[model samples]
Structure formats: C-alpha cells, structure tokens
Target: MQACRSAGLARGLGAVTLPWLWGSCRRSLSLVCAGSAPRAGDWRPSAGLGSRARRLSLSAATIVNSAPRPLQPYLRLMRLDKPIGTWLLYLPCTWSISLAAEPGCFPDWYMLSLFGTGAVLMRGAGCTINDMWDRDYDKKVARTANRPIAAGDISTLQSFVFLGGQLTLALGVLLCLNYYSIALGASSLLLVITYPLMKRITYWPQLVLGLTFNWGALLGWSAIKGSCDPSVCLPLYFSGIMWTLIYDTIYAHQDKRDDALIGLKSTALRFSENTKQWLSGFSLAMLGALGLVGVTCEQTLPYYTALAAVGAHLTRQIHTLDIHRPEDCWDKFASNRTLGLILFLGIVLGNLWKEKKTEETKKTIGSRLEN
Candidate 1:
C-alpha cells in the first residue's frame, strides 16, 4: 500500500533521528572533562543528568550505542527486521481474501486495506508483548543484550505504555471490520499474550507462534463472508502455520546457543543437528498445503505458476541456509516476505484472468443466442 510506503519512510526518519539524538547527547557528555573523580559533595547537577552526570552519561551512551540501532529495535519489536514473521502474519489474510472471493473477482480495495492495517498493528502489538516478557532473558542473550528494555532506554512501565498504545491502534483497526471478524480478531489476544511464555515451558513455542500468526487468515475469510467454512480456510491457515515453522526454525538457529544457556526451548535447539532435514520437511508441507488451497479455490494456471515461484523461493532458502551462521539464518528467515507477496500477487492475477474469461464467455453466448 502507498500508506505502508509512507509509514516506512516515517519509520526510517525516526530511525535516523533517534541515533543522531543519542550520539549528540553522548558527544556532549564526552566533552565534559573532570579533573578527577568527583568528591561525594562536590558534584553539581545539571538538567536531568544528576550528580552522577559523568557516570550516567557514559552508561547511557554505552547503552544507546550498543542498543541494536534505534530502527532495528523498533523493527525487531515489530518483527520488521525479520519480515518473514510479518509475511507469515499477512499471507493468511491474503489467503482468506482470495479463497472467499474464489471463482469470482479478487477482493475489493476495502478488504485489502483492512487486512494491511490489521497486519501492521497486530504485528507490532505481538512484538511489544513478546519483548516485554523477554526483557530479562534478552539481557542475557548476546544478540538481544542491547534491546531497549534490556538496555534500560525504556522502563517496564514505559514498555506497558507502548504496548497499550499498540493495542489501542490494533483495536481501532479491528473495529472497522464486521462483528464476526472483530470477535475473531479479539479472540487472538489471548494467544498473543501467552505466546512469549510458550518458549519458557514448551519446546514447541514455534508451533504456538504459527497458530497465533495465522489467525488473520481465518479473520480475513470471516470478515468477508461473516462465517468460516473450515474446509476452505483451515488448509490455508495450516499452510501458513507450516511456513512459519520452517522460517522460524531457521530464525531460532541464530539464538540456539544463547537460548540453551538461558534454558529457553525452541525447535531450533530441538533440531540442532538435523535442522536441514526438518526445514526440508516443513518446506514441503507448506508447498503441498498451498497447492491444495489453489486447487480447492479452482485458481487458474497463472496462480500455480506463481506458486511455483514461491516453491523456488523456499528452495533457495533451504539450499543457501547455513545453520552455523546467524547472518545466513536471519537472511533466510527474512526472505519469506518476498515469497508471500509473490504468492499473493499470483492469486490476485489468477482471479482477474478468471473474471475476464467469464465475462468474454458470457458475451459470446449472448451473441450466439441472438443469432
């Protein structure tokens, strides 16, 4: 959406400004030279820096500098840095829209707009809740040690405030939908709230995430039709879930060591040695379910061709994945968003072609009848 583009720009600006502000503050602190460590009563306070201005500045600067770049923390909080999570969140809604409009034209502009809004808000809310719960553990993890919460840029109270703001936005988006869709959307909050704790008690937290993220698919269909046909939406929902499993497993590779040390459980740690095999199986399952969804919806050949592209995308992820390297793992995980969009565009095009063919056929039959 153009709005998403604009939002991205705004987010980018915020990203740039946050670091600049922090750096400036740090520079000011660095300029302050003390002849020696201050005596307890000799310290003078200025602004909010307090009596420990030097120590506070140094700590603040180190924390801010070490914090995963402002934009990154925001993105990670929204799971934007790892876009596969967003795609996995978005595709279900896409699948629901396509399926509900099956054998006809594509979903209207309103449906797409609503789903887009919901995706962004819900994704953000989910991340805020997750980071809130994981702040303590995040401080212990190498990659996450500098997160906003862990590094103290934001306090627990501030995190809850941010979370409330995100949820309010999400709720506003949900209210734009029908009663059924709203209810369905509201129902997902429980899963979202508990998702962060899933890893603490279960090795299959990724599975919980799949279920939580894919709820939008059902909401999409329910929004349009007012009720779900399990036969239609279930397979697509499950497919999205499988896709999440595959990608998030790759994601977990980046934190397996840290997770183990923190006593956190994940499929990444569960399938450490045999990650490739498990990823392959999950990838195949995702493709197969997607194929079933296409067939069930009677999608045109173009849609299948697009799905073939998705298959290739997944194949590339699998082949190029280096579970040993965290960067490679993140790259593979983030690539799923492209795959999701490819499939979504394919379905939309297929619907368009089907509509054009139907219209042409109707005109031909009318002319023959008149003749």
Candidate 2:
C-alpha cells in the first residue's frame, strides 16, 4: 500500500512539475495538474500561466525577492513591501495641496509628485531611524524580530549611514520648495529623530508620531501657496493628527503583548481596555476639526458628503475592531489609507465645486449688467 501511494505521488509530480517549471521559466505554461498525464512528446502547457506570472511579478514582495541579494535587506528595511505607511504620510500633503489650489484650478501636479517623492524618502528615513533606535526591542517582538537591523542583517553603523543618505535625499526634495517651506520642512527633523525614543520613555509615543507624520499637512500648503493660511492649514493639520492617533493606536495593538513582556510602552498598553472609548473620542475630534476646515475654506456639499463617508468608515472600524487579535488590528490600521484617500478626494472635489460656483456667479452678474 505504501509503495502504491509513493508511485501515485511520483506519477502526480511527473504530470504537474513540467508545466509548473515551464510557467515559472517562461511565464506561459498552464497548470493541468489534475488531468491525466499527456504523452511525453505532445505535452505543452497552456498560456494561462502567463497571467499568474505577471501578477506575481508585479507584487512588491516578488520585486524584493527578485532583487540582487545585497540590496534585498535594505529594500525590506525601507518597508517598500508595506506601502500603507507611505500613503498615510502622503495623503495629508495631497489634502493640503488640493485645498490650497487657486479657486478655479486643480492642485499642482508637479508639487504633488514632488511631495510624493519626499514622502517615500522621509518615510524610509523615519523607519531607518526607528529601527536603529529600537533594534534591541525589535529583536524580542515577533512581528519585528526579522527586521533587517534587529535580525543582524544590517549593522547599526550601516543603518546610520543609510539613514544619512535617505535624509540627504529628503533635504534635496525639501529644497525644491520656497525658502519658508524649506525652513518649515527642516524644523520637522527634530520630531522625526525623536519620535522613536518616545516609545521607550512614555506611553504617548503615538502622539509624537502624529506630530511627526503630519508635518506635511502644514508643508504641503506652504509649498504651493508660498505660506500657510492658519485658518485652513491649522485645522487640517489638527484633523490629520487626530486621524493618525486613531490608526497608529490600532497598529500599536499588534505589539501590545510583546510590548508588555519587554517592558516597552505604547498607547495600546496605556489605553488597554478603554481603547474603544479613546478611539471614539479621537474620531469625533477628527471629524469636528475636518468640519471646521470645510467651514473656513467654504467647501461645498461634496466635501461634507466625503466627511460623512469618513465618519461612517471610522465608526465601523472602531466598532468592529478586536484588539486581542493582531490580524484584526493590522487590517484596521491598513484601512486608514482608504480613509485618507476619501478625504483627499473630497478636498479636490470641494475645490472644483467652489470653482464652478464662482464661474456661475460671474456669468450672472455680467448678464444682469448687460440687460
């Protein structure tokens, strides 16, 4: 009976291995593993496998895996495999830029692209800085145990050097803005450098993160308009901070157990059982501040609609969240990117609506005068 099972396994492999190999090599082999074996001379995989190969190749993990060995560790160090952080950092910039656009125009595409580039660099730098500081702590956390620095794949000295390169590149991007923006962007460095340490000393590290991560909300408007309008930029910035508090708290829950074991602190540990209540408060404050932004900017109905959508999304997130489950926490944290995009779209549409109203008002006044 054992011999018969072995023979069947070998036969199954003979039928399936060839097509799988061909697909991997040429991206054009069909997998027909369940069918009877084809005659050796006539066997050929179908082209359906190419689609699967294309999708696999497009994934960030695949790209990182395919990279040269020496570069792979650094790539992972930058968290390129996880782009949600980049989105979270960049979305506020998009919001501010869209809101700051001239009354009749779209946001500046060039500035958007430039800020996007800066977001990637600065976020990478922030990660590198964080890893360097927390490498010891990370080695004990299951989620972070395999991180490049914590796993000894990269030395602290090497990470520090890489961090310098990332910051230098980030500074180049900052220089592309006006003098005030450059000065404003430079001021954020202290926050970035210090944020990782907050986790060690206090439970409110996520608060410090909010301050660091949302600097772009202030910088984005100044980058385009040459300066910030406090009424618009301030409330927008506050709303972003509250938004960050919501998501990062959810994220911290993933490590709460490990953090407790290691004597590290986080909002997850700080809020413990009352996390839902705190999240609700933060959500309400975020919505209130966003509402203020709309009022001050004279945003249209579409903007208010988007805010309502955002409110519903957050309410669902908080209500459904299970803090004890790491996977659930991660999913909730990841979903904030969608929340960010919703608000950004709202701001863009709000600006367009305002522009349309202005055009109609001008036509009305001109026709009345001519009559």
Strongest candidate by TM-score: 2
Q: Please provide TM-scores, in order, for all candidate models, with all chains considered together.
A: 0.76, 0.85
Question: For residue 292, what is the lDDT in candidate 1?
Answer: 85
lDDT of 2 by residue, 137-186 (tens): 99998889999999999999999899999999989889989999999999
lDDT of 1 by residue, 36-151 (tens): 11121133446464444443333222332445665445544654333334445766687677667645454544565556656666777888888889999999998888777788
Model 2 CA deviation exceeding 4 Å by range: 1-57
Give candidate 1's TM-score: 0.76
The local lDDT score (0 to 100) that residue 310 gets in candidate 1 is 85
Model 1, stretches more than 4 Å misplaced? Answer: 1-84, 102-104, 363-371
TM-score for predicted model 2 compared with the true structure: 0.85
